[model samples]
Target: MKINYPDGRIFNSQPSKSSLHTTNAKKKLIFGDRGMTLEEEINESNKYYRAHDIAVIYKKPTPIQIVKVDYPKRSKAVIREAYFRQASTTDYNGVYNGYYVDFEAKETKNKNTFPLKNFHQHQIDHLKMCQKQGGICFVIIKYVELKRYFVMPADEIFIHWDAQFDGAKSIQLKDIEKGSIEIKADYNPTLPYINAVQQLIESGKEKK
Candidate 1:
């Protein structure tokens, strides 16, 4: 599949586009390519929203504590090693339709269920804080095996997460089926994520 950008550049994958970058920490390289990593797909979807003036969102760069740096030459200083400052929040967040939107994008190759371990405590805490601040918080879960995605509200997620203390390690597929808004892949903009956002906002409005 090839998508020709307005700049006359044809992209075979989402990562090949200008807006997304992946870091090869081992190689110490930041490279962009024209392929669809799950991250790249979501980034591209966000770009679509931005172009339509619908929303503004971006991935948060992981906070890292630099331990050592080597300057082999005058032009560039190489970061030799670093550790995460803390567990990261969601993949993206921004304002849309005068409302704050926050969400994490995750993909699972597993056929049965998405493991809760994919999400971190700090992420849950961040989402809770955002919810407290009157923002919309949700998770964009991709069942890669099925090529399907769903948008699940933070409230629903919290319930299951809280149950983990009672010995539930993961949420079942049936649970997600009942609680999430599923999204199908598309061609024009690839994943139609903004549609999921719209559904989430409308559902929130209905509740009030």
Candidate 2:
């Protein structure tokens, strides 16, 4: 099957990795070609959770606007031209243990710090709204080169996001260690991030 766009372009099936991320990803030592992306890992785990009755989390699908389509067969159709509808606010959101769980997953190649540039202001604002509504909000960060995973609460993220304006471009590894819950990736559901979510819920109770 072949799709030729009216604009002399081929089918825009999926977004290329380079086009999806910032230009910094190309220059940085991301070491990402070796394994699954953070989004894929979380999605796989979400599937497992659904099957096992653990949680009902899912990756919110990005809405795509199809400008052109080609139907070579009666049942097969190819998108010749398409574009994303809007910037998605967060990655995964759902219910866990009677609580609303919302989070964004991010992976970085930096060894010293997780660059705040990886996040957007709208994502932060979405977390804020969820938190105010008593939702358990956080971010799952994966260090590509280090093979480390951490679930940092939305509050900690807000602190660093605001500080970026005052010269803090990233969150130090030590600070992340102190403020977040570490998750050891495993075999069953892959990354058992829901365990960290449990810890966050407990901590919220403690604070209250």
Per-residue CA lDDT of candidate 1, range 1-208, in tens? 6652333122433232223344432132112222355666676666677777988987776667999999997679989998757646776899888989998888788887778988889899999999999998999888877777888899999998888899888888889989998987765466777787788889889999
TM-score of each predicted structure versus truth: 0.80, 0.81
After superposition, candidate 2 runs with Cα above 4 Å error: 1-34, 70-73
Assess candidate 2 and give its lDDT. 0.80
Residue-level lDDT tens digits of model 2 in 1-208? 2311123111222333443764543332133223666765676577678878999998776768899999997678999999866555796899998999999999998897889989998899999999999999999999988999999999999999999879999999999999999998765576899999999999899999
**Residue ranges of candidate 1 with Cα displaced over 4 Å:** 5-35, 70-74
Residue pairs with colliding backbones in model 1 are 13-34, 13-35, 15-33, 16-33, 16-34
The alpha-carbon lDDT assigned to residue 11 of candidate 2 equals 24
Rate residue 204 of model 2 by lDDT: 92
Worst 10 residues of 1 by lDDT: 25-34
